[model samples]
Target: MEWSVTDLAERDLYKLLVNTVLPRPIALVTTVNAQGHANAAPFSFFNVFSHAPPLVVLGIEGRDLGDAPLKDTMRNIRATGSFVVNLVDRALVDAMQVCAIDFPGDVDEIAAAGLETAPGRKVAAPRLAASPVQLECRETVSLSLGTRHRNLVVGEIQYIHIRDGAVDERLHVDIDKLDLVGRLHGADWYVTMRDRFQAPRQTLDTWRAQQGALRAKPEGEAP
Candidate 1:
């Protein structure tokens, strides 16, 4: 029931952490190399860290094959200083998985995955056409963590592209219409946002009013 991370293997710790996390958003990141080659990969260790300046963080790991020093996506970001974060939806799940493969550095993942790319307005990196949401970002900071295993990439949102009807002029996005998918534990596992319900947090006044109503009710009365 209890396991010490230091004692456990890295793979064991990774499995425990990922499974316990339940579900995480998938960032299908796209970046352009110095030679203009496009690279795409899906990262589950990603999330929005700030909103005022529109910032997001990506937790990237070293190459599993030990063949390279940096991940192609990370290398491209460092070379170009720009990247695109595309939301992985149910429609593009298969293609996204293909991009996750450990392909050669020169391989064009966008073409290899057979996914359509759209020219970004603000950034040089092309956005995934199938993705419902695409955020063009400029690298703000690339912090080296632990020397080897981890790298935290922080990016500032330059421009956002949402699918038609998904967002309004006020920038309010309709979640139901987006049908976004998230990464689950294990290989090829995914979760959908279609089955969703809202449970608003109760205020102090609202809680007091509910308590008062309960106290006023007869002992035998149903709530």
Candidate 2:
């Protein structure tokens, strides 16, 4: 079966993408309003795009639920040029959900979620005290797309904060200890990193060794 994107509705296209994307990391972003009120929201459309500049990219939808209502986080970043990306661990999953609610502009999502906050070293946006890992990022660039004009926020990570027990002397993170969770298909669906597997990458020489006799030799040169 085949489907043309143009023939499909936007909602259907979005559903198709989400359902097939597997699990995505959650970013519980925190920003500050002009009045210094702390705002927190969870966005699954987020990931680290680069390490050279230490960039984190977040795909922010239009402001409102039905129409572009102008999200507080977007406005705050546009106004202040900085925000914090907090990792969602098992302990903070419920609080992250509370922050995802579509609250009024005046409502402080962080406060409403009953999460504690601490000032960031490199940005005005605060950090979620419950989060095991947090990134203080400064807006470096933004791109707009989609008919509703969604914003792609690309920010440079200025500083990273990790819980004392999460990392080791060599700066290796004990991922399991971090207890991070990821977003699934539906509103309440999620996955833990506890279950994982590993596969070693292969090089050409290794590949040739594995297929010794199977490899083709010069025509009639040798058996």
TM-score of each: 0.91, 0.91
lDDT by residue for model 2 over 1-223, one digit each (tens)?
5799998988888988887797999899999977788899988899999899899999988854666455777888998999999999999988887898888776777888999999999899999988999999999998987767589999999999998888989999998888999888865789998788898899999888767855566567665
Candidate No. with top TM-score: 2
lDDT of 1: 0.89
Off by over 4 Å in 2: 64-68, 213-223
Prediction 2 global C-alpha lDDT: 0.88
TM-score, cand. 1 vs. native? 0.91
Worst 10 residues of 2 by lDDT: 63-72
**Using lDDT as the measure, which candidate wins?**
1
Candidate 2, pairs of clashing residues: 63-70, 64-69
